[model samples]
Target: MWPRGDDDIIRSNSLHESWSTGALNIDMLFPTDYFLFQVAVCSALLSAVSPLRPAYSTALENALRNELFVDRNYSLLQRPSQQVDVRVSLTLLTVNELNVKDQFLSESGYLSFSWQDSRLSWSNTSATSQDYSNIDSLFSTELYVWTPALIIENSIQDMSVISDTKIPMRITQDGWVFWSPSGVYKVSCESDITYYPMDTQTCYLKISTWGYSKSEIGLSLEIGTPVDDSFYRENGEWDLLSVAGHPPIVNARKGTWYSSLGFSVTLRRKPIFHVINTLFPVILMGFLIPMVYKLPTDSGEKMGYCLTVLLAYAVYLTLISDDIPSTSKTVCLLSVYLGLTLTFSTVSVNIVIYILYAHFEGDKEVPAWIDNGVRKFGRFTRREKRDQNKVKPSTKEEHCDDKKLTAILENEENNNEEHKPITYREYSDILNTFFFVLYMAAMIILTIIFLLPLLINYLTNG
Candidate 1:
């Protein structure tokens, strides 16, 4: 019935099961070769052709290599009869530095430019007509520049952008090439730092074609929305108020006239940081000079405090000098204030020396004129100072005992009574009160002289 014994038993069982259940288990009898044949046929049909296409970047490069020409303006490098009027605009990304001393500006931005190439133009070659134009990769091609002689004038250094665009510059069917390159430019600019931290400064960026005259190369800046507000970034110390561009330059050099497009940037300095760090502390120290005179001459700290304040002002002056531009033509207002206060400080030191000298007089009565002058300043009595400074006055018993001792001394030395006039302690009180009044007056005058003009200026400006 069957070739093998197991097959013969299985075939009989299957036939019985089929008659009993009307169902067949045919997989148990299928041959391995037949299964393999079916798999092979399916695999061949599925893998008949590849679904991939050529890469876009490669196709764009091929299109550029095949069509666009970039070397056509070389013959007229020396004597050019015709020139392309290129339209240009700039989008600021960063303002690196506006050097006041060096007279230059460093900037980074994207330069948007559009120009027509006669050789690259196509008519009826719109996006629908060209198959490659429909594909985005075909437009990403390295265009050949026919005119390498064309260059930017008034560019001090490094006009070319650091990072070039990888996406090939697209050219419309009408021969318009819209190209934007990211560039870093350093242009020479004139600045006036007269007011410095509070000053508003204006710098200019000029662009023009080099080696080509007005008739050969015509340059015009874009008009609408000239400075891209969204693209501009913030500066740390300066606020950009406005940026305006126009063609305002007609420079003559070596018997040739050159025209240029000018971009003026108006900026104001943010002075809060400098005021807090360098100016406020110095002003506080200047106001503290009066405290030196308030100390009694015996404390011996009046000169020390005066000198310390003077030295502090000196240090601040040095600090500010190192940062600002080194020019004597325009001196800062803060410097003048420091100089005046420094003079007052020097005078204060001398006044302290005089007070110490007068306070130590040995049994010499102060002259009538000095006493009269002291009275005119109003009485700066020892009682008032002792009470105000919180210094305790000697008890009443101490003065009574001193008077008794002096009476006994006078009785013993009656022969020298006519020569002796007043004690040193009494003389000191008179002089101290007079000079103290004078020192306070000086402080008030100095403060008013320094601050009045500044206040007036602020109110007037506002």
Candidate 2:
């Protein structure tokens, strides 16, 4: 008889009743056979009503682990094959910062690396009677498995190999291994600041197999989009234009070939920030430079005004210079514009000094050439006004009065043989008017030449 515990007392009583009710005929079996049948029936019923036993997941994992890695000699430094082809892909997460002055790009992302290992492959029931066919994959780490050593080719930060034993690597039943590791990566990039705030920069994130030759471990991108930006967050100061992956490039050095894959991130400056903060002010000051001549000489702010504008241009140039690398390979157009405007301000200051000297030179006779030029310009303007006002005389009386006035003017001109010379004040006034118009025209032309292209680019591409 099977031993019964207090927990099975109720079940035993129910079974006795079922037997007494003739559910099983006692005469149909012999005494020993009935006892054996009772034991068999009770065992089956207990098993059917009992709670489920623990699964064989841990056992299957232990078996698979022992079969695959226990004695497989999977060395981290060793490749699975002499020529293992690694499939590499990148997914961009965030464009943290791009330092134009330092010529570097900082970003956060992960890399998906996949390759096959023939040694780790196994059938579903290789180690036990239980069918582990439901198990699709297994997990391991770099500590106990062989993984390709891939690294950023142009990294500026940590140059060490990527290895984290804590991160689990997925291994499939068919020996396919997939590993994804993520971190912040910084890479060297060439900055082209020619258009400056209106520029579009393409920076590359390059990857390579470290310590492995191109023949030892080939690198290829997956067939789909290799550089995925589906999870990208927009940068406030920059707009992402495109992200593209390039085919593997075979590079040779010192009689050795290395394989590298590249992904290009094209970004354009948002321009609104720079336009309001930098370019707009520079332009506004360019126009303000001509106003120095408009201020009265006696107001005592002529020199101060000119110096103030020169100082403003200097400050703006310094500010913009901080954003670009100090490289001679390319010069920013905005810098050139600022320099030219600064020079114009300097010229205006010198002109102010000269004008003050003329104003203080009391009663000085203007030179013959100066007096003649000023008088000729003044007379030409007056003559044009007179012609516009003149009209034909309609009455005989008006004609006689016009003839009389003409005769009197001719006699007065003949009598005044020697006229007074031009004064210093008049010469100063002439110089002021001429330079005001000249400077205004110059400022407008400079805006059109240096700044129009920037505006056009901003409008077209913003």
Candidate 3:
């Protein structure tokens, strides 16, 4: 057949006459059929788009259709055997986000997995999809393969849906299965804060089937080797101690068994940062307790200094309390120690008040108790006591010649010098010296008794 030219195609052949000059002419291209040409081009484009796939390969498609693709609707456990035994394993990528304050740990990892479905199997002798990669080289036709819907049972409370996938999976003729799924999950963990800031915790990752119980789909864990050091990256916040998964546990509810696997993730907190930021400052402020007694009441800063230190302690307590839950089952040991220090600080303030009052008692005769108490606790030697008690004559040779005396007065008739009154300054000096020694002794005893034990435990175990 000859190709039809545009002239052979239909076009308007009309004679046109100019109205003004009355000249006759013939036009051929007028009223051309562009609508017909447009329909022809569209038909060509549609034919290119929907190319014939392997489904149209009647020999292969018929082979697979007879042997493999017949069963689209059947029971979930499509097996000749009574039970579908499915074993699951895991390959960890990382554990990135751990929120101690929220009591949940976020894990990013995938499942190393396989399963069996006998219904979707056939002979692979005469097929293009014999090899796994060959299935890709063939036309875009993967037999719709259904996979199990698994889930994490012990995940965070806020999660409404469990982490999983729903895409159609693969099925081999030999009934071997393979699928790997990765996700980031926040598993709930209850931390023990008995030694907290220096504490170790064990969090669990649990896996189980979402709908089916063990009677339908039996679950098993292949706990081959414990987690290696290189399995997870080193975290600045925690040190991974060991990862262990226990044997499958069977749970029976309403006369049916449910199977699941439990993995324990053991970790110890890196506490050097906690020690420096939260603990050292508290301890340093506590040591200043001794200086409160040593400050002379005359300077009027002794009370003010004590209150300021107390206020600082209050701020530290507030900061720590915000980090640690008030409703926690186990309280931190550092918090306990801080509470004890605050108690001691309050006692010091009381002691300061009493001493200041006694020192300023004006012109009252020195009580006998005061003299005995000063001598007993103030470290005055026997010679010093005797010299203090003796009367000195007006004559220079009879007196203990201490020229540091600020004042001297003479009697009118006998020209004898009067003895000076005992001053508040003198009593304050004696009290300050005595209490400084007392506070130091108490601090040493408390350190040995209360604080050392905790420090030793951390050194041995941390």
Candidate 4:
């Protein structure tokens, strides 16, 4: 009689029935139920000889056939039979050609991957059906949606890339697609039989594709290694090995596969020759104006010329603001040049006013009362006209006698001497001296306030 348990009856019937009958009945029973009973009996008989079996013979055979398998789906079969865990590694190669759409606004580069595997599973342990759809869309490709944990290591040091082969890439209506001469492969078991097997086995997958017209690219690998609680116990640290290849010539850096490869681009203003051409002349003009102050103020034309330069600098300052970014902190050299020009122009104005005033007003003698008080303190004083008048000839009595002397002196002077009138040239000389002294003083004060502070600030910041 058949055993009481349905499972025992299935197993016994499978062993005793003819092959044709059993094959026909196999579909009637649940495949898992039949496989479980067979596995129990097989475990008892094959435990001693199981170690002798090849570690990855079926997996290697699949690899030779250009077929790849992952461990996730296979785990369900192994779990019922309590089989040993298995691990496998695969390598993939991809070549990419890129074309940048906007060279001024964007840049282009290529990505090459050396090793890629299909066994690694994602870390979304609590993923719901919605989460799975989201993640699948994120990493889906035109040919297949690989649920593998991709590890990327960037060998490019100077440049950065956006995606590697094993990235969470998604397909959109306008999204990138992968094309291969060999058709794409889907998930499958390593066994030649159509039914899932209870035996434990590991498989490796190698995928190769080229990414063209890409903004940036990188390389990475995937594996079936599970990340447990201990994996996250410490900081998530991963060590990645790099395959053989020369580093990219562009701005690149050596990076590890433990983290995702990332890239970001910014639009920068290109250095324009026309902009420099426009600015260079303006800055030169501003600097040149300060030198005009060195011309002697006696030239009389200095003030008019300096005013014209100051106006030009102001106009240039207005124009420059349109080109440079508003948030830039750098004080333009042009601004400094314009400031110096304006300051010197102000000094020029002061000098012109001073000279014009001194020209009109000659030095006036201090009043007698003020002079007397000043002299009491023992300060030096100029001789007053009153003091000179006091020394006039006291001999009025000799006036009559002097009158005869004066008449004879007048007669001799009229015959031998001619009188010359005095010129205002002395006043002009005095005005020049005073105005120059004032100019020197103003310059000294400006230097103390503006130049010294600038020097101190520069040195401290530097």
Better of 1 and 4 by lDDT: 1
lDDT tens digits by residue: candidate 2, 3-28: 55775676556657777996865555
Q: TM-score for all predictions?
A: 0.63, 0.77, 0.67, 0.30
Who is ahead in TM-score, 1 or 4? 1
lDDT of 2 at 213: 92
Error of 3 at 18 (Å): 91
Candidate 1, residues 9-89, lDDT tens digits: the string is 776677567647867454544354347557976888776743233344665545543654333332223332266666667
By summed lDDT, which 10 consecutive residues of candidate 4 come out lowest? 192-201
Estimate candidate 4's alpha-carbon lDDT, on a 0 to 1 scale: 0.35
lDDT of 4 by residue, 93-121 (tens): 22111111111111122232222222222
- TM-score, candidate 2, is 0.77
Model 3 per-residue lDDT tens digits across residues 1-462: 435466654322222223234543323323333454457668888878643344334565555544454433534344434566666766555778666677878777666555665555443443434323223211111124445556677887434433334523445555555565567767988877767677777888887765677777677775464233355677778877777766778777688778777778777888889889987788788889888876767788988888888788878887887766454698777778777778778887887887687667644545566655554544442111213434345566445554522133112211221233334445655666677777777766765655676677667665
- Index of the highest-TM-score prediction: 2
Q: Count clashes in each candidate, considering only residues at least 3 apart in sequence or on different chains.
A: 6, 0, 0, 13
Error of 4 at 406 (Å): 40
- Candidate RMSDs in order: 14.9, 8.4, 15.8, 24.0
RMSD of 4: 24.0
